[model samples]
Target: MEEKKMGLMKCLFVLFAGGVIFLLLLAIYPFWLLFAKVTNLIGVKGIRNTSGKLQTPVVFYEHSVTKRIVAFVAVIHIAEPAYYAAIQELIDSLKGYKILFEATGKLSPQEEQALTQKEKDISSQFDFIFDLMKKINELMSLQYQKDGLTYSASWINTDMRLYDLIRAFAQQDISLIKKGRDIDDPFTEEFGQTVARWFINKLFSRFIPVGVVLSVVAFFSRDKRVAKRLILDARNEIAFQGINEYLKDSDIVTIWGAAHLSGIEKCLKKSGFREVRREWFTAYTVRDYSLFDAIKKGMRATKEAASAATALKKD
Candidate 1:
């Protein structure tokens, strides 16, 4: 009888240990995404606020008591950088649902190459602009290193490029800027200087109306409000596209900033989704380091390691 009792106790101990290990694994599973979001240095957290009410983290789903639609939402707030693996996990989880990502537009091949060159080029004339942008990105990265912070450098670049593009269009000699025939310069006397202004404005607006409008709006209006409007419009389009393409035939999942999703959630609610759910996904935050800051941190760590090694040698 004593031997049998000892055997039973041993079996219980093994089972308890296994259960504890499994639980710990499950808890830390979300951290694995640190590689994609933080390591790659690209990605945003989805977060939003609307109607004076903050959207909290809650999983939304729809079921009809006896049946389920198998649809759901998993929101990743971009306040903190997201891991690429987290994105993959999000895609896998929502594999049952259609996926829509609210993000900055992709750079044109030429634009991307140009931007890369701009970063690498050592130009005395453009150093001021280069340093300004580097500083801005560094600061932005640091702020976003905080928990619940999501950001997209792509969005920042896009806005800057669009503004620059439109300004160039507005200020350049349009007829001659792109190897086109010059408009009769002699006609300026007939129409007056106002004609020149009107002609340029019209040309700029017609070429890329969105940028033109945004530029003009920005000149007179606050920047954040304009960005919010643009993001809202983009969110609506993404949601609509997803619903139209996948709602009836397949499931969908979307990744975007939390702020953008408030608009999307509203769209989903109005579109007859009985229940909308959200899940708060988290990853370790990285401090946004400036070029200087990164260098400093590296040197500090190296010095510490060297000091420890010297101590060991003396001992």
Candidate 2:
């Protein structure tokens, strides 16, 4: 009976795997057709090509909102050796200035207690995901630095904090995943690990790069209503610090995440600040390899985009 049961399990696994492969194969043609059509759009063409550099993805935009020029240096957080060094370098490079940082705000005692309970609840339901994120952040050095930054943090806004929204999203993700899962499934941890690995691999797949993901987020971020309000309050922080102090040569530098850059830039523009200088630096390394690989991929993508655009023009 045991042998028979084992055999039945093997057969079911094979059938499931085959079905998944078949669906993927069926998806390719439609995806290709869609990609072909999307290449013709004007702004999309610039993004699809090698116009951007291969770095950890940092932007240094100069804003003259105050009497002194303020440099809003936006960066995406990454947990890697080089990423840590790049952050330090950024801090070191901008000396003798009042630096305003994007800070996670203090939680009320009740909120803190609720968060603790949520952490416990999350561990019980999605231990694998929580543990993995924790490990990755630790490995990548992905936490805010107090001593390294050498500055007091300014809340992007007084009324809202980023962590509060993230907690809400965490609950939402938990609820969605739990509702979709089967009660009798025995491979809880293993299943979670498999899905996480597969999803990340798909993101880094040859056809769809991480840049494209960021571009999508950046595009939607233009709408303040749809995008998370956490980063949206960057304008508030700029105003709060900008109004607080000003000197003939004093510069207020804002070190925030790249995801918030576009929105922050838009807000700065509204406040009459113009971009005086811009520079890019690496923010995250997708692969644990040399930066050359990223550069080569960028070049290849640009070549492909250019060819696609030319073909569309001829048509």
Give candidate 2 regions above 4 Å deviation.
1-20, 26-58, 62-67, 105-132, 138-227, 230-249, 286-315
RMSD of each: 26.2, 14.2
After superposing candidate 1 on the true structure, give the runs of residues whose Cα lies further than 4 Å from its correct spot.
1-87, 109-221, 284-315
Q: Report how far off residue 92 is in candidate 1 (Å).
A: 1.9
The 10 consecutive residues of candidate 2 with the worst lDDT sum are: 43-52
lDDT string for model 2 (113-155, tens) is 6675654454344445444455445433455333334453432
TM-score of each: 0.37, 0.52
